[model samples]
Target: MKRIVCLLLFCALSSALPVYSLTFAPAEETAAAVADFERGQQLFHSGSKERALATLRTSVQRDPGHPKANQAYTLIGRIFIEQKRYPDALLYLERIPAVMRSPEADLLRGYCLVQTGDFAGGQAQLLPLLGQSFSVQDTELLLLALTDAAVNLQQPLNALFFIQKALPLAENQASLLERAHRLLQGHLSDIELEEAAFMWQGTAIGQDARLQLARRALGQQQQQKATHLLQMVLASDVTFPYWQEAEMLLQRSSMDSWFNRDSIGVLLPLSGRYASYGELVKRGLELAVREHNRTRLPVRLVYRDTAVEGVSTSQLVSSLTDDAKVMAIVGPLLGAGAEEAATRAQLEMVPLISLSQRAGLPQRGDFVFRDSLTAEQQIQSLVRYAIDTQHISFSVLRPENRLGEEMTRLFVDEVRRFGGEIVDIVSYPEEGTDFRKQIQSLLWEDYVVDIPPKPELPEFDEFGLPIEKKEEDKKEPEELEYPLAPFHALFMPDYAERISVIAPQLKFYGIKDVTLLGINGWNAPELVERAGRFLDQAVFVDGFFSASSQPEVQRFVELYRQAYEEEPTILSAQAFDAANMLLLGMDDATVRNRDDLRQRLAALRGFRGVSGTVGFDAMGEAIKQPYLLGVKRRRIVEIN
Candidate 1:
């Protein structure tokens, strides 16, 4: 009923609503009214609007349509609006030319239109008034008018736009955001979030918008995007109320709910047997954080040594998992350590980006991801090269260990897939030194002994007469030469210690000219010292080659050497790339929690990284391209 009455009143009086900003007569035409106009302006400025209105009436009567009269009409219209005399205000305001309309008068007429329920019309009237200067009270009223029109018209997003503008001016930002969130929850599109980011850029609200956007990226498993979005949070003031959580998300970048945590766990064997390896990875982590902390990004790094105080790997990982403040975990170089942390990470739904690889470590859940090379990937590359080189028959020789067993499966799959055959597959104990027995079984070790001696035959002279055979030589049995094994190549997935013994034994056993293929474990330069000339022409695949001449690779090597005074090994290179990958990938994924970061890392493909092209296979493990290295004259050279 009240609404009906308001509607009737709107129909009766709305026609008189202002079409403001009309052109007025020039000041020369207002000369006759100058005295009254001056008095009216003085009275208005002195807070005597009632006296000013009477004086302004005299000015308009003397010089009709004068600019001074238009100003008088605007003041009178505003007065009538305050007094709730809507039709009277609109009658005075309508005479004003559009060009002559003051911001104050437009707001007043816009308010009248909305109060009378002509929301769209009122919004249209105020649209032009935006981007104009107004007092605090006037700005608040204008915002209220925009909000009302937007809500009544069912344009919620438009209302949000106005609310965002007023957020900085609001008395309680949290309350405003809470209310706004209810209205906006699922209505905002990705593009709208981005637009809000731009609209609120350089303000706290902008950061919040970016956080929202980062959540989307992380949800899609785009790590770098998340990192980029959260980087801004780190660059902000640590004193911010949300700084601790932002820092946590930046460090680990778990989820939006987890973004408020402030610490990230770095679990490495920093104090004991693997300290050197830990140092290499730590250097990469430091460099990554140093480059990003120019803005004092709020994340706090908590380094936990896996070998600390005799703590076991599982114990350390479990303790970190229990640390409510630790939002993400990014270490544990040992495969066992990563595996130990994997289950707890999944259960907690936190993210764990391990720098080591173990079967089923990250495969069980989206909570864990690896950026380190594995035996499967290394063996796949080596087998592919062997097949490509036309070596159709291959002998697989490896240590009797888990890695060897796993690598054997991968090698056999690829070799047979490419129309090749596994001529022989042999395994020796990892601690074995004498592999002659093993090599002999695969080669021509017994070929000389297998055949009985034959009589030496006489050579014929040029004259066609048979020359006499030497009596002693004819009685002596002829020694026979043996051909190598039936296989054209050998795929050895063992490291230098074992390969050195095995490689030479194969050659000593009369196996020559056989293509020798190896996995990343053969990349150590010491293999030349151990295997000596036997390593010649041997080709192997490796996760990283510090000596690579790629511009990016060269720069990393120089920087790493300069910073640490040592040549970087594959471990250091992979660790560096891992750290850098997390940092850069997060930018693309934006700032979410660690679980989202795990997904992002898993979804990565062909991301050009320092270690290799960092990507993930279907099982959520690193699909890094290992370099094919050939030993030529005891020197390492990259093979195509």
Candidate 2:
């Protein structure tokens, strides 16, 4: 069945070839040139592109003035284009005599220019071919060229005019036409619409008039006619441009659609030592799925154990890929496993939502989305809060290991960039026990000594007390004083226990005015309990703050508590986010292809999640605004 479907799809794609004009020569042409031209045409029709190109080139060179030669030259250019040899194609195309240059030649030349990265030149060549009678192939290629040129020129709105003009020409090439139509269907800004239309106008028009009509009908909200037209169009060519959109729309029109159901997949490290985290993630997924289903989301949740106890990552990927029913795969939260999963998901075109902090994973596939916050983003949040919200001017602290070192470097760089300064940077080994010396050095204390140059005979009365009698009899020695500048804030990248010990000692040295700041790692209870009074005024940035006033967060917190009987961690929130993102994108499988998914994900906005509002950038990285929290009465309290 799969093979049959694949074969059918291939046939559909093949039949959707764009229309192209075929110019015939006048009887005045030389017989040799005419014979060569016919032979080249046969070769082109036979798919012997290289031989066709050579024959066509020879014919054109032999009889440059012959109409047959001009036709052969145009055909040769198209052959080169099909072979993606744009430069060679352009040379032959340009050889066509001015009077022999047909619309097809101009279209082919335009396509070659685009292929050769001369978008502006291609646009100039193609604009003249607009409104001309063209083959579906020629029209589709021309529209594609126009769109590419417009986009390259950053004139998105200008692309739309070309798309509208080419829409009717795409009768036979339904898929290409539909693509062009869809590219312009949305409420695109002037620039975007123009660019999209221009790009579409360059492509060849397909023969499927019904597909074009359906797309137009759909654009006009003529749902029933659009659906019927699309169905008719797909009966002949399922790979039509509007095929995916039609299918999705048809499914949507039905009350019971797959999209309305709770389709979820959970990825976890069920077989390794991190099994506990996996179980936690599974619990979160289950909780969210259940709640979602209860709301009549019609959802179903599935779990995949990304455990390679003895097998290789390849084996794990094979196991996962075998399950065609899986919609979204989440987990394998371990860094190595997540990386492997990312690569595998990219290959399989499955969305793998990683729950690990390894931000170095290159966001590749649309299906391979991550829920983890990057260190750079986290640092930026902290810096913003410190500089803007808290008005902190100076920071003095140390980082523990390589990660900490990198974080410290980022923090310093951001601080300086944000008009802040670093007063003192104390580097401490992770294994260091006593931080007192380091703290004292940063305190900038002044040492003063009072002594007499020569000791006078003691003029003591009863208790052998050397009480000075007169000011003249007393002498003062020179005193040296060292001044130390005070820092307004301290950024401690250490874990809770170390920070706890360092915090109070800093206060003891009359540095109570210095506020303590910490990173996400300091959100642990151990840090609060061990640090005790020292952490009273300290602030930190954390991912999961249950005190959020947002209803989504409140619901998530409640549901999580009911399922796991424990508070949800940032990891759990991330898992939830990953699930939501995958499900949201699975709405349109046609557009759910890897690249499409990646673009959609990047353009997502205002998506609410337990981890806060999650959005993605062009690189497919998650960007979430972190919450600022303070340790108040040993509890993490959100600071507005």
The whole-model lDDT of each prediction reads 0.70, 0.64
* Ten residues in sequence with the least summed lDDT for candidate 1: 178-187
lDDT (C-alpha) at residue 334 in model 1: 83
- List the candidates' TM-scores in order: 0.54, 0.54
Q: How many Å off is the CA of 522 in candidate 2?
A: 1.1
Error of 2 at 552 (Å): 2.3
Candidate 1 lDDT for residue 117? 72
Clash count per candidate: 35, 60
Candidate 1: residue 243 Cα off by (Å): 34
Supply the TM-score for candidate 2. Answer: 0.54
Could you tell me how far off, in angstroms, the CA of residue 76 lies in candidate 2 after the best superposition? 58
